[model samples]
Structure formats: structure tokens, C-alpha cells
Target: MRNLTQTVTRWAPTGTDAAGDPIGYTRTEILGRWEESQQLFTRSDGTEAVSRAIVYLASDVAVGDFLLQGSSVSASPPSTAWRVEAFRKVENLRGTDSERRAML
Candidate 1:
């Protein structure tokens, strides 16, 4: 679709075959919007904590496997890596293939 939020790029970490063979780098394409959220909370010790997460639409290809937090998605060059904290399934997005939420 023409109105996709951003181009999600996946960089697969090296994999090993059953015979102990090496699998080269693999790149895949996923489309979604990467957003940053912050929440402030007070602890019992009166300490403040800011929770940050990069939220995005889950990828149909990854299926939440072989995905690490250090990887990231970018619309252009100079990307930033985000940690994968949690994932939740959300309403089906328009013009998208998956209906899940990813907390990076």
C-alpha cells in the first residue's frame, strides 16, 4: 500500500544448519510504525522510573522467533537499535498483514 507508516527491516542473526553449517545474513521486509512511549511511576522508595518502549506492528515473517532486542527498524539510514521487551496482539491495522503489537 502507498500509505505504509515506515519500512521495517529485519536482520537475521547468523544461523546454523542441522549439519552445523553456517547460514549467512538474511534480510526481510516488514512494514509498520515504530513509536516511543514513556511512563513515569513512583516506587515505594519514592524513586521515579521512566518506562520506555518502541512499539510497532508485529511482523508476519518473524513470528516472534529469532528476534532479539538489539535489532531495530528504520525508515532511512542511521537507524537505532531497540530492545524487544514484550509483544501484544492488537486490532488488525489497515493495509497491513499482521495485527499484533511489539514492544521494543
Candidate 2:
């Protein structure tokens, strides 16, 4: 399988509790090399937690270069549920598949 680099761009919470405080945080993680198609993974932590992975194919990138990124969330409260949001491409990196895909 082809490989690509993935990066985390944003991670925040969504919704609010009765006290008017944010119930949880939502996270948007990006994966891929610069100048290439990038994949995005969105996850949330709250009363209703959710997450998803998206693949983006850019005009500059080849079909095999498109890689999807996955994500997961861990909460202090075990009762909180985690769900998938959406899957899409967000950014792109550089280097060969082996180089870009390697996580340091």
C-alpha cells in the first residue's frame, strides 16, 4: 500500500454543558505532505463524541499518492462516547512515500 505523511492541524471541543461550559473538545488532524493531496481526520470529545477520516486528492498529486488519515480520542470520563465526524484531505507534504510516510 502507498504511504503518506499525516499531521495534526487543529483539535478543539464542541457543545456545552448545563453550566454553559464546553461539554467536550473537537480535534482536526491533517495528514499528508506539503504540495500534495492531504487527508483530514476530525474527532470530538463531549456528551456526543465523534470523529472521521477524509482523503483529498489534489491536482498536483497522483491517485496513488492520496492517503487517508485516522484519529482517536481519549477522555478522562470513561462513559463519554467517541464518534466519527468526516473524512477529507486537508494538506500535503513533500518527499517520497517512504520518507514522507515515516513518522518521527
- lDDT string, candidate 1, 33-57, tens digits: 6656775544335666554655455
For all predicted structures, in order, the TM-scores are 0.44, 0.22
Q: Give candidate 2 regions above 4 Å deviation.
A: 1-6, 31-72, 75-104
Each prediction's whole-model lDDT (CA): 0.48, 0.33
Give lDDT: candidate 1, residue 80.
52
Residue lDDT tens for model 2, 1-104: 13335442333446667877657654444554423233333232223322223332122221112122344443321232222243233343553322212111
Q: After superposition, how far is residue 34 of candidate 2 from its true place, in Å?
A: 13
In terms of TM-score, the best-performing candidate is 1
